[model samples]
Target: MKILHLLRLGAFVAADKRLERKEIDLRKLEKEYEEEDDMELEDLDMWDERKPKQGMDTRKLDGRDHITTWSEAKKGQQLGMYVNTVPGLSEVELKNLFDLWQMNMINCCNFELTFLPLEEERMLVLLPDGKHLKDFGTMLRQDKNCLTFVVENTHMLCGGHPEWDPKRPGKNVEAMEKWDQYHKDKKIEDTKKKVEGWKESIPVENKDEL
Candidate 1:
């Protein structure tokens, strides 16, 4: 009993240490996020000539038309990477997790996530380049909790966000359905395998006894 108590205490201490380390990491990431928020990433002096914006007249058009001005988009031409956080994470918690992921991926690729006001759960990651997408994918697999994926074909997104169309399904909506189906199928397959194993484990005489 004494040995068991000592082992339990040791496990608690180890868990506490892990929690402390995670808290410290979060604090550091928060500080970095604050600093990065202040610094706007502008065109570097070393960059060569880029495409100029095509000007168009918009004297009296509806704001809903979307193409209001000739001004360039804030996030230049970058690859749109999407992550569906459909697991009931709050806005703040999701942002902190994304910030932590960004911190983990230092020196690989520089990018930031944009969460739409309407679609808060889906994160729009604007990757500046495609060189590190695979690297990020490898790291993503290590994080069993992270749902990092690119949904294709089933539903469409407008401007890196899902549009609520009465006619068509939204992006992650279809993706989530597919995910559920995948898990359901896997469960059935696993159950079958377990049944086979159990059948093989029974004695040969017992197999006939039923």
Candidate 2:
């Protein structure tokens, strides 16, 4: 009689498990249906023509715009470049830097370096003005193993003449080789340090204790 009672309890539990699975399946189906409905609504909305929403002219926002115009866009040409004046950077300093960079890159191509994008990698273009910037020059500076030569003298560096000739093949080849070696050496050193660190972090086991 006790065994029969236990069998009845087991049947009830099995029925409950099947019912729970059906509930879960129903929930998943309902969620999928809702997602499909959302996607359809999005597609319909895309067909509707809409204009960009303009920001409301608030006094606080208007004040900042006015300050930017007076500060960065002090000149006629720079007025176009003035998006917003960053904090801490003075208006005059920002304008001067922007004008110098723009004229050096666009007007004169007088940059110390010019970065050209390649299929797999990008190439740096060295222009006259780029030499003045610490980061730009540092990137091109060669180590003992690499060759470093002046592509442009003081005359060309100053943006003295409007027209400048192309870089020499000899200089280009030497610079490229140097940069390649520098990167290779750096990679090898980094790998060695990483291996050393990993070995140090490994726990030492005692055979006697085991």
lDDT of 2: 0.35
TM per model?
A: 0.34, 0.19
Candidate 1's TM-score: 0.34
- What's the lDDT of the predicted structure labeled candidate 1? 0.49
**Cα lDDT tens digits for candidate 1, 98-157:** 777777677555544343423655666655534344455445444534543452322232
What are the per-residue Cα lDDT tens digits for candidate 2 across 33-80? Answer: 546555444332222233222233343232312222222222111111
- Model 2 quality (TM-score): 0.19
* Most lDDT-accurate candidate: 1
- Model 2 residue 203 CA deviation (Å) reads 1.1
Among all candidates shown, the one with the greatest TM-score: 1
Reference-based lDDT, residue 118, model 2:
25
Every candidate's lDDT: 0.49, 0.35
Range of the 10 consecutive residues with the lowest summed lDDT in candidate 1: 65-74
